[model samples]
Target: MGAIICAASLVTYTSVSAEEAYTLTIKDHRFEPAQLSIKAETPVTLIVKNLDASPEEFESKPLRIEKIIPANSEANFTIRALKAGRYKFVGEFHEDSAKGELIAE
Candidate 1:
């Protein structure tokens, strides 16, 4: 009985500690949502799905994150807790049109 209770507690803790998730779609050389809002000081999982035929490099200097998402493929990134501000990102392959920002508040 004690072991069962401990396992249950562990499960609850795991669920509570899980980070929030957000999805961003790339189509027609642009981001579906030009801006995304998130809670400051909270970790999150950002999933970038590329629907375009060419690969794109998700780069953000301020966030210090960069990843290459293959054509028609998706990639996942773990964004650590950040202060309240705006972090801009752009697709290196399509700098002219593919742009977005993460607003933490």
Candidate 2:
């Protein structure tokens, strides 16, 4: 009985520690919902979906993330818990149009 209880507790902890998820879509070299708001000091799972016919590289200097998302597909990224501030990101293929920021508060 104790072993079962311990196993259940572990499962609960695992779920609680899982990263929060958010989605961003790319179409016409632009990010939908260009500004994202998230909780500070919480790990995040960012799902970037590319709707265009060309691939795009998602780059964020502050987040230290640089990933290539293939055309008409989606990619997942794990972001560590962040401090309260804004982290900017851009699409390498279309920096002028594809720009976004993550605001953690």
Candidate 3:
């Protein structure tokens, strides 16, 4: 009985630690819902979906994240817990139009 209880506790803890996911869509070289807000000091999963016919690079200097999302595909990124602040991101392929920021508070 004790062993079973311990296993259940471990599963609960694992689920709690799992990162919460948020999604952003790219269409017409722009990010839909260009601003995102999340809780600070919590792990997060950012899913970027590209709905355009051309590839785009998702980059954030503060988050130290850079990846290429293929045309009409999606990419997932795991972000570490962050402090309360704003992190800016842009698509290298369309810097003028593809812009967004992550607000953690």
Candidate 4:
């Protein structure tokens, strides 16, 4: 009985620590849903999908993330828990047109 109880408790803890996921799409050299909001102090999984025929680099200074997504492909990134604030990101290949912000509240 004690062993079963411990197993249940472990399952609950594992579920609680799992980060929520969000998706962003790159189309026409721009990030769809240019702005996103998430819970503060909670880790998150960011999935970026590139629909364009060319590759794009997801770059963010404040978030300290950088990745190059291939054309018509997708990539996943793990973002640590964050404070209540806004973090800006851009596509290094198309800085002028590809811009977005992540808002934590």
Residue 102 CA displacement from its true place in model 3, Å: 0.3
TM-score of 1: 0.93
List where candidate 2 sits over 4 angstroms from the true fold.
none
Candidate 1, position 86, lDDT: 99
lDDT of 1 by residue, 1-105 (tens): 999999999999999899999889999999979899988999999999999999999999998988999999999899999999999999999999999999999
Q: Could you give candidate 2's per-residue lDDT for residues 1-105 as a string of tens digits?
A: 999999999999999988889999999999998999988999899999999999999999999999999999999998899999999999999999999999999
- How well does model 2 score by local distance difference test? 0.95
TM-score of 2: 0.93
- TM-score to native of every candidate shown: 0.93, 0.93, 0.93, 0.95
Query: Would you list the C-alpha lDDT of every candidate in the order shown?
Result: 0.94, 0.95, 0.96, 0.96
lDDT of 1 at 49: 97
Which model, 1 or 3, shows the larger TM-score?
3
lDDT of 3 by residue, 1-105 (tens): 999999999999999988899999999999987999988999899999999999999999999999999999999999899999999999999999999999999
Give RMSD to native, each candidate: 1.1, 1.2, 1.1, 1.0
Residue 73 in model 4: shift from native, Å?
Answer: 0.8
Off by over 4 Å in 1: none
- TM-score of model 3 vs. true structure: 0.93
